[model samples]
Target: MSEVTERRAAGSPADQRLPLLQLLLVGFQHVLLMYGGAVAVPLIVGQAAGLSRDEIAFLINADLLVAGIATVVQSLGIGPVGIRMPVMMGASFAAVGSMVAMAGMPGVGIDGIFGATIAAGFFGMLIAPFMSRIVRFFPPLVTGTVITSIGMCLFPVAINWAGGGKGAAHFGALEYLFLSSLVLAAILLVNRFLKGFWTNVSVLIGMLLGYIVASAMGMVDLSGMDARPLFEVVTPLHFGAPSFHLAPVLSMCLVVLIIFVESTGMFLALGKITGDEICPKRLRRGLLCDATASFFAGFMNTFTHSSFAQNIGLVQMTGVRSRFVTVAAGGFLILLSLLPKAAYVVASIPPAVLGGAGIAMFGMVAASGIRILHEVDIVDRRNQLLVAVSIGMGMVPVVRPDFFAALPAWMEPITHSGIAMTAIWAVLLNLLFNILGERGRDALCGHH
Candidate 1:
C-alpha cells in the first residue's frame, strides 16, 4: 500500500479494528445507507426503456451484482485500481440524463446506453491520471457549489417518491403522505435519542418500522409479485449486444467527465474526514477503480458506476472508517445479488418508505457541501458571486425542467443534470474570477 501522509493515527477510529460481529453489523449499516441510491439508476433506466416488470427486476439484480463487485474492488485494493479507502461504489445518478436520452432515441435503447457507458468508461480511465492533476481546480468554492447542486437536483426525485411516485393513480394520496411522515419521524426520533451504532442505523430502523406499519395499513402488498428463482447467475449482454452510436457515446462521455469532477470533491472530502492527504497517485487509482467498474458494469448489464457520496456521510456519522467494513458490505451485496428472491424483497420496499430516508440522506449531502463552504471567505465579493451564480445556474433544471426545451436535443444531457451544470459553471467562474485574475493569482503566490 502506498504510504499516505496525514492519514489517521494508528489507534484512530479509522484504523481501529473491531470484533467480527461489530464489523458485520456496521457494514450492513453502510449498505443500508446507500441501498436506495444504488438501486435507483437501474430502475429509472429500465423503466425509461419500456422494459417489462420482469426485465426491470432482472436489471435490479444485475445492478446489485455489479455494484457488489465494484464496492469490493474499491474498498479492497486490487493491483492499480482500488483506493483502499472506506468508499462504496454504485451506479451514478449523473448518467441518468444521458442514458434516458439514449433510451428514448430511435433505433437506440438499453443496448445503446450500455454501449455508451462502456466507451465512456474507457475514456475516463485513459484520462484518470490527467484528471487527478487538476485537483486544485476544485477549491472549496467550486466543490461546495457542485455538491450542493447535486443534492438539490436529487431533492425533486425524493419529493416525487414521497407523493407516491411519478404517474401513480393515487399520487399525493393522504395515505402516502402519512406513511412518509411516519417514517421520517421515526428516523429523526431514533437519531435524536440513540447513541453510537443505533444512531448510525437510524435509517434502517425507520424503514423497518415504516414497512410494518404500511403492511398493517394494507399499503404493502406482494400478492401480484412475480416469483423469482432462489438462486440465479448474472449473465453478460443479457439484453443483447450493445449498439454503438456517436451522439449517445459523446453525451455519456461528457457525463463521465462530470462524474470525475464530482468524485474529486468526494475523495478530497473523505481525505479530510480521515485526515489523509489526497495525492495525485491515490486520486488516479481511485478514479481508475470508478472507470474500470463502469466498464465492467456494461458487460454485467448495468449502467455507469461511481463512488456513492452518501456513504461519506455514513463514515462521518459512525466514526468507523475501516475499509474492511465496506468490504463486508460488498460481500453482503454479492450474497443478495445471487439470491434473486432476497433482492426482490429489498426491491419491494415502497418508494414512499424510501422517501423518508431519502430526504435525510440527500439532505446530509447538501449539508456537507455547506460545511465545506463555511471554511471559505464568504465576505469576498468574487467568492460570493461565484457561489451565488453557480448555484443559480445549477437550480435551473430543478426549478424549471423545460427552461431549455427550445434548445436542440443534444443540449438535454447537460441541461437535464443540475450537478453537471453546476460543476461546469463553478469551475469556469472560479477560473475567471479567482485563479486567472491578478489579485487572486497574487494571493495564491503570497504576494499580498
Candidate 2:
C-alpha cells in the first residue's frame, strides 16, 4: 500500500514499468513462482533434524513468515538492510548442509547451534559492507559464468519436480501433470484473456483452482487445518534455544558470506534487467537487509535468506519491476506464517505441480544467464572455458553428492553446495583468466 514514486528508468520494459494492476499480478505471480522453494528448506531441514511431521509443518510455516518479512526488507529496505529493488527473498539452499550439520533434535540437543545461527546471521550483516567489494568484480566473465552456473546448478531441482518427485510411489503420475498443467494453464490463460488485476492475480487464481481440483479429486490433506489453532503466533526461539558451537557457527558464517556472494550476482542481474540504480551503495544496503532477514530467520529457527531465484523469471515474464508488488507478497507471507491453517493448505500442493513450475522458472533463469553471455566475447575461448568449468564445478555435487564425501567434515559445508562452489570457482577463474585484478574493477559486470 506504500506509494512508490512513479519514476521510471529508460530502457525499463513495459511490464517492468507497468501500472499498479499489472504489477500486482506480476508480484503474485512471483509468490507462486517461489512458494515451493521457500517452504522446502524447512521441510528438508526439519526432517534431517528429526522433527516429526507436525513439527516440520510448523517449521515450514515459520520459514515462510520470516522469508516474507525478509523479502520486504530486500525490496523496500531500510538504512542498509534492503536492496530496495524488486527482489524476492527465500531460504538459501546454501545453508542446507550447514543446517543439517547442526542437526538440532527435539530434546537433549545442541542448543549452541541455534544460538550460533542467530549470532552468525547478525555477524554476516555486519560484514556486508566488505562484501560489497564483490560487485566490482562481476564483469562479463565472472558475472556471466556465475549467473549461468546458477541456472545450471538449479536445473536439477526442476527435473526432479518433473519426475513426480524423488521416491514417489509412481513416477510421472497423471495427477501431477494435470495439476501442473492446470496452474501453468491458469497463468497462460489469464495473460491471454485478462488485463491488469485479474491478469496479475492469475497465478494465485491458478493455484487456487488447482488446489480445488486437486482437493475435489482427493489430492489434498486438510487434516492439519482441523487440528490447527485459530491463530498461531510465531514466538522467538519457538524451537530449541540458540546453540553457539564454534564449529557449527563458523560453518554457518561461511554459508552466510557465500550467500552474499551469490546474492551479489543475482541483485546485479535484477538491477540490470529492471533498470534499477542498484549501484555499489544500494547493493550494500540491499545485502545488509538480506543478511538481517537471514539473521532473523535463524533467530526464528530457519535457514539463510536470499532473493528467490525463481522470481527473476517472474519479473522477466511480467515486466513489473516495481518492488511494491514484492512488498505485497511479503505481507501475504507474513500472514501465512501467522495462520497455521493457511500454511497447511499451501503445504498440500503436489510435488509434480511444483516440479512443472520449477522447470519453467529455473529454465528462464538459465536462459537469462546465457543471454548475458551473448554480450561476452565467446570467441575468446577463455570465456567459453570459463562457462564450461564453472558450470561443471557447480554440477559436481548434483552429479555426485558423494564426490567430496571422503574429504574432512569441515569441507562438507562448501562441497555440498553446487552454487557456492560454482560461484567461488567462477570468480576466481574469471579473475585469473579474464582480467588483471584491479581495485575499482567492473570487468565482470553483468551485460547491461
Candidate 3:
C-alpha cells in the first residue's frame, strides 16, 4: 500500500491528541464553521410561525443545546448510537421548507412541526438498521454527484451572506463584498504559508481578521450584545406539547428519508477520506445517531437533526480526522447553548465574514466530490451522463428556487431541496443505466 493509504488505514491523524488549549481552539473553530447552518432551521421556522423575537431567540438557543448534545453523542457514541467519527450533528436543511409550511398551517403552527419531527425521528430510528441494505446503490458516481449538487445548492446562501444577507437594507453593498473578499483572501494566504495546526485553523483566522477590519470601519454594531442574558436553560416543550397531525408527520417522515440518504453518502465519503471500512453495521450506527438526535431535538424544542456536511468538508480540508476534535466542539456548543451571552458573541460575527469562510469550506465539499469522481470510470458514457444530468437537476433549485412554486405544497420538501432532488435522480439513474442493466444482461445471457 502507498504510505498515505497505509497511514489512513492504520489510523487517521484525528486519533492523535494536541494540547488542551489547542484542542479547544481547534474544536471551537469547527463549531464556528457550522454555527450558521446549525441555527438557520430555527430562524426559518420561527419566522414562519410569526413568533416574537424572544421566542425566536429561544428557538436558536434550543437548537444550539440539542445540536451540542447530538454532536457529542455522535462523536463519543452511546450504546448503539454514534458512528464514532468526526461527525458534527445539526438541524437538517432538508426539513426547513416542510417545517415552515407546517408552521403556517391552521392550528398546527410550531407544535405540529415538532410533533411531526418527533414522529419522524422514531420512524428513522426504526428504519435505520435497514439503511445499509441500500448502500450498494451508491457507487462513487452516485455519491459524488449528490455531494457536488449539495455544494452547488448552498452557493446561493453564501452569496446572500456576502451580499449582506437576503433582506439587508444595503444588500449587495460594496462594503460587504470587500469584507468577504478580504476574509477569503486571508484564509487562502494562511493555508498556503502556514504549517501544522495553524494551517488547519485558517478559516477561523480569516474570519477573525475580517471581524477586526469590520470593527475598525465601524461597520459592526456591538450594542445588541449588551442585551443578551449571561445564562439560560433550554426548557423542554418550550412551544408547548406537540400536537401530532398526519400531514406534518408525513412531511417530516419524508424529510427523515432524505436525511437518511444524505447521511449515508456523508458516512461513505468520510469512510473513504479517513481510510476506514464502511460496512453495513457501521452505517447503521451513524444513521441511528441521526435519528436519535432528531428524536431528542423534538423534546428539546428543536427541529430534526442530521450530520452536517459542512463539517465533513472541514475535516477533509484540515486533514484533521480526529473524532475528539468534534467531541471538544460539542463541549463548546453545549457551553454556548447554555450561555446565551457567548452564543450571541459568536452569532454577532458579520455575515460577510462568514461568507468569506463559507466560500472556501463549501467549495471544498464540491472538490471532495470531484476527488471521489476520479475513482469512477468517467470515460464511460453512462457515468458521464449520470454526473452531468444529476448536477444539472440539482442546480435547478439553487438557480431558481421558485421553479417548483407552482407545485403542490406537499411537494415542498422534495422539490425545494437541491440535495434531495439530486440524490433521487442520481440513484435511480445509476440503477437504471448501470446496476439493473447489468443484471438484465446477465439474465439474458444465462437464458441463452
Candidate 4:
C-alpha cells in the first residue's frame, strides 16, 4: 500500500497529522477565513459601549487571545472539555443585540456585560449535558434544514462584503465589485487546474492575489499601524471588575442558550463535512468547550465564544480534516494577539476579497446540507413539510432582521437567530410528525 494511504488509514481524518509547513499554511488559511468574524463581536460591542479607539483595540486583542486559547483547547482538547474537532472558537454574534442593549443601560455598561457573560457561561456548562441529548432530534431532516438555513443566513453577509462591506463609504463601488469578481475568478481557476495541496489552499491564493490588486488600488490601508505597539500582552479585566445585574444576567443566559443551539448545528455541519458522526458524547464535549471558553472569556475581557460556522465551509472546500490545523491556527491567533502590527496586516485584507472566497465557501455549506437531505426520505410528505417549513422559518430573520421587533423583547434571542429558529421548528415538527406520530399509530393499532 502507498505510504500516504497507510498513514491515513492509521488514524481518523480528524487525528491525521500533516507536514509542519502544510499545518501552518492550512492553519493560516483557516485563520484568514475566520478572522473577520472573530473580531466583529468586539468591534460591535466596543462601539456600542462608546469605548475609545484604544479601548476598542484592547478589546480586539483580548478577544483574539481568548479565542486562541479557546480554539486550542477545543481542537487539542483536555479531558472532557473539548470536542477535539477542527472547530474554531470565536465571540458569538448572537450576543450582540443583547450586549448592545446592556451597553446602553444606566449601570450595566461593559462591566455588566462581562458579568452577565460569566453567569451565562456557567449556566450553559450546567445544561450542556441535557442539551447534548437533543442530538437524537437532529436526523437528516433537521440537520439538513438547519445547515441550509445557516448558509442562507450567511449569504447576506457575503453579498454585503461583495458590495465593499455594509456602511463603507464606497459601499457597492464598482472597484469592490471588480475586485470581488477577480478573486472569485482566481479561486475558480485554481480549483479547476490545481491538484491536492494547491486545491486546498485555493482560497488563500485567491485572497493573496486580490490583496495585491487592492494594494495597487490603494485599498489596503496601513495608515497608523506603525503607531501601534510592537508587542503587548492582553491584560485580563482591562475593563475593570464585572458588576452583574439580574436582568442582564438573565438576558445573556438566553443568548447562551441560543449559542448552544447554533453551535450544535455548526458541530453537526462540521461532522458532516469530515465524515465524523457527531454522537451525543462528542456533542457534549464540544458544548463543554464552548461553555468553558465563554466562562473564561468573561474574565479575560471578551464576550461569549462559540464554534465558528464559517470555518466549516473552508474544511468542506479544502477537504482537510485534521483538527491540528485549527491548533496551529490557534497558535497564529495567539501570535496575532500579541503582535498588534501583525494583526492589523491580516485585518487589512479587503472585505471584497473575503466576499469572493465567501461565496464559494458559504455556498459549499448550503450544498453540504442539501447533500445530507438527499439521504432523507425526502419523498415523504411529512419530511418534505418539515424541511420546507423549517428553512422558511429560518429565513425570516435573514429576510427581515426586524421582523420580530414588534414581538416582546424576551423573544429576541430565538427570533433573531435563523439557525436557532430553524432548529427549533425542525425539531418540534419532527417530533410532531415522526416520533409522536409513530406512537400515535401504535396506540391506534392496539385499540383496533
Candidate 5:
C-alpha cells in the first residue's frame, strides 16, 4: 500500500486535533457554509404552512437547534450513533415536497408533518443497517457518478445565488454577478498564493471580503434585526402535539430512504477525501445518527435531518479533515439557535457572497468524484456505458426537474433529487453490467 493509504488505514485524519483558534475559525466556516441550507427547509415549510412571522421564526430556531445537536452527535459520536467524521447535519430538502403536501391536507397540518417525521425517523433507524449494505454496490464507477451528480445538482443553486438568489427583487443583476465572481477570485488567489492554515481558511477569508464589500454596497439586509428577540429557547411541540396519519408517515418514510441513499454517497465522498475507509459499521452508525436526529427533530419542530452535501465540498477545498472542527461548528449552531440576533446576522450575508464560495466548493465535490473515477477501468466499453448512462440519468433532475413531473407523486422523492437518481441508476447499472455479468461469466467458465 502507498504511504498515504497506509497512514489513512492507521487512522482517519478527521480524528486529528487542531488548535483552539483554528477549530473555532474552521468550525465557524462550516456553520456559515451550510447555514442557508440549514434553515431553508424551515423557511419553505413555514411559509407554506401559513405560519405567523413569529411562528416561522420559531421554526427556524428549532431547526437550527436540532441541526446543531445532530452535527455534534455525528462528529463526536455517542456509542453507535455518530459516524465520527466531519459531517454537518441539516434539515433535508428531500422532505420539503412531502411536508408541504401534508401541510395542505385538511386534517394533516404541521402537527401531522411532525408526526410523520417522527415515525420516519424511527423507521430509518431500524433500516439503517440494511441501508448501509448498499455501500457495497457503490464501487468507484458508481460513487464517482453519484458524487459528480451531487455537484451538478448543486450548480443551479450556486447560479441562483450568483444571480442574487431565486425570487430576489434584483435577480440576475450585474452587481450580484460581480460580487460572486470577486469572492470566487479571492478564494482562488488565497488558495494559490498562501500556505498551510491561510490556504485552508481561504473560503472563509474570501467570504469575509465579499461580505464587507456587499455591506459597503448596502446589500446586506439587517432590517428586522431589532424586531427579533435577543434570546430564546426552542420549545418542542411548538406547533402543538403531533398527530400521525398513515399517508404522511409513509411519504416521510420514503423521504428518509432517499436521505439514506444520498447520505451514503456523501459519507463515501468524505471517506475518499479524508482517506478514511468507511467500513459498513461506520456507515450504519452515521445513518443511525441521521435517523435519531430526524426523530428528535419532529418534536423540535423541524423536518428530517441529513448530512449537508455542500460541506462535503468545503472539506475537499479546505483540506481540514478534523471532525472536532465540526464539533465546534455544532457549538456555534446551538449558540445561533438560542441567540436569534446572532442567527440573523449570519443570515443577512447576501446570497451573492455565498454563491461565489459555492462555485468553488461545489465544483470541488465534482472534481473529487472525477479523481476517484480516474482509478476505474474507464477504458472498458461496459464501464464507459455504466458511467455515461448513470450520469445522464442523474442529470435529468438537475437539467429538468419537471421531467419526472408526470411520474406518480409517490416517486417524487426519488425523481426530484439528482443525487438520489444517480445513486439508483448507478447501483442498478453496476449490478447489471458488473456484478451479475461477472457472475455469469464465471458460471459459464465453470460449465466449460
Candidate 6:
C-alpha cells in the first residue's frame, strides 16, 4: 500500500481536540459550504409533497438534522459504515430529481416517499458487497469521463442560481450578477489576502460579507426568522410512517442501485485524488457508510445520504486531508440543527447566493473527476468507444429529461437518470469490451 493509504487506514480521532475558536470556525465553514445542498432536497420535496406550510418547515429542519448526523457518521468511522476518508455527507443531489418525479406520482404520497426511500437504502446496502467488486473498473479514463460529466450536469443548476434561479422574470438581471460576482470576488480576495484560518474559509467569509451587503441593501429578509421555534423535537418518520407497497418500494430500489454506482465512482475519485489506494475493503466500508446514512435519512424524513463531491473539491483546494476537521464540522451541523433559530439562519441563505458559491464548489467536483481520468491511457482506439458510449449514455437525461416519458412510471428512477445510465453503461461495457477483448468475446467465452 502507498504511504497515503497507510495514513488513511488509521483515520483521525476527534478526541485529540483543538483550540475552541479554530475548531468552531472550521465547523462553521463546513456548514456554510454545504447548507444550500443540504436544504435543497427538503425544500424541493416539501413543495412537491404538497406539505402544509408548517410541515414543509419541519421537513427542512429534519433534513438539517439528518444531514448533520450523516456527515458525522461518514467522517467518523462507525463499524463498516464509513470510508474514514474526508467525505462529508448530505442529502444527495442525485436523488433530488427522482424524488421530484416520485412526489408527482398520484398514489405515492409522503408515506410512499418514506417507504421508497427506506427501501432504497436497504437495497443499496444489500448491493455494497457486489458493487465493491467493480472498483477496479474505475481507471483514469472512466473517472475522468464521469467527473467531467458530473460538472457538465451541474453547470446549468449553478448558472440558473447565478441568474437568480429558475422562474425569475428578470433572470440574469444585473443585480443577480452583481450579488453573485461580489460573493465570488469575496472568496477570491480572501484567498489572495487572508492568512491561515481565514484563508481556509475564504468561500464562507465571502458569503458572509455578501449576506451583510445584501442585508444593508434590503435584499436580505428575516421577517419570519423570529417566528420559528428554537427547538423542535424530531420525530422519526414524522409523516404518518412509511407505507411500503410493491411498486414504490421497487421504484426506490432502482434509485438505491443507481446511488450505489454513483457513490462507488465518487469514493474512487476521492481515493485517487487523495493518493489513497481504495482497495475492496475500503470501498466496502465506504458503501456501507452510504447505506447506513441512506437508511438513516429515510427514517428521519429525508432523501438519500451520500458524500458530497463539492466538499471533496474544498479538500483538494484547501489541501487539508484530515478527516478530524470535518468531524468537528459535522458536530457543529448537528448542534445547529438542534437549535431551530440557528438552523433557520443557515436555511435562510438566498438561493442566488448559494448559486454563486455552488457554481464554484460543484464545478470543482467535476474537475476532480477529470483529474482522476487524466491518468488513464486512453490513446488506444478501442478505449475511445468506452468513453464515447459511456458519455453519450450519461448525457441522455441532461439533454432530454423527458426522453423516457413513455416508459413506465416505475422505470423513471433509472431510465431518466443520465448518471445511472452512464454508470450502468460504463460498468457493463468495461466488462464487455475492455475485459473481454475486441473481437474475442465469443472466441474466449464461447457464449456469444
TM-score each candidate: 0.89, 0.87, 0.93, 0.95, 0.96, 0.87
The global C-alpha lDDT for each of the candidates, from Candidate 1 onward, is 0.79, 0.72, 0.83, 0.89, 0.90, 0.72
Predicted candidate 2 versus true structure: per-residue lDDT over 1-448, tens digit per residue:
2213343324333224456666555666676668788888888878777778877877777788888888887777665567667788988887777777677534323255457667777888789888887776677666666666667777787667656678667777777777777777876788799886675565567667776787788877676479887688777787767766776778778878877877888887786667664567877887888778777776787777888766776666555667778887788788888888876676677666666556555666677778777886778666678788888988999899999988987676678877778778888877777555452244544432
Off by over 4 Å in 5: 1-11, 439-448
- The candidate scoring highest on lDDT is 5
Instruction: Give the per-residue Cα lDDT of candidate 3 at 139.
Output: 71
Model 3, position 167, has a per-residue lDDT of 62
Off by over 4 Å in 4: 1-10, 439-448
Q: What lDDT would candidate 6 get against the real structure?
A: 0.72
Candidate 6 residue 15 Cα shift, in angstroms, is: 12
Q: Model 4 compared with the native: what TM-score?
A: 0.95
Q: For candidate 3, lDDT tens digit of each residue in 314-355? A: 788777778888999998888998888788878878888888
| Better candidate by TM-score, 1 or 2 | 1
lDDT tens readout by residue for model 4, 299-390: 99999999998899899989999999999999999999999999999988889999999999999999999998887678878788988999
* Model 5, TM vs. native: 0.96
lDDT of 6 by residue, 1-448 (tens): 8433456466533222446676666667677777777877788888988898778878877777777777777767776777777777888766666677768878888877887788878888888888788776665666667766666666677788778878677998887788888888887777788787777677777778778876777666677888888788778978877877776677667767777777777777677666777788889888887877787777888778877756766665555566666787788777776787888777666656766776776677777866655555566565578778987888888788888889876666577666667767776776776666764443222122
The lDDT ranking, best first, is 5, 4, 3, 1, 6, 2
TM-score of 6: 0.87
| lDDT of candidate 5 over 147-243, digit per residue (tens) | 9888888888899998899878989898999999999999999988989999888999989999999999999999989999999999888778999
Error of 4 at 361 (Å): 0.2
Q: Superposing every Cα of model 1 onto the true structure, what RMSD results? A: 2.9
lDDT of 2: 0.72
Off by over 4 Å in 2: 1-24, 52-54, 104-110, 181-209, 437-448
Looking at model 4, report the run of 10 residues with the lowest lDDT sum: 439-448
Error of 5 at 62 (Å): 0.4
Q: Which stretches of candidate 3 lie over 4 Å from their true place?
A: 1-9, 439-448
Q: Find the 10 residues in a row with the least total lDDT in model 6.
A: 439-448
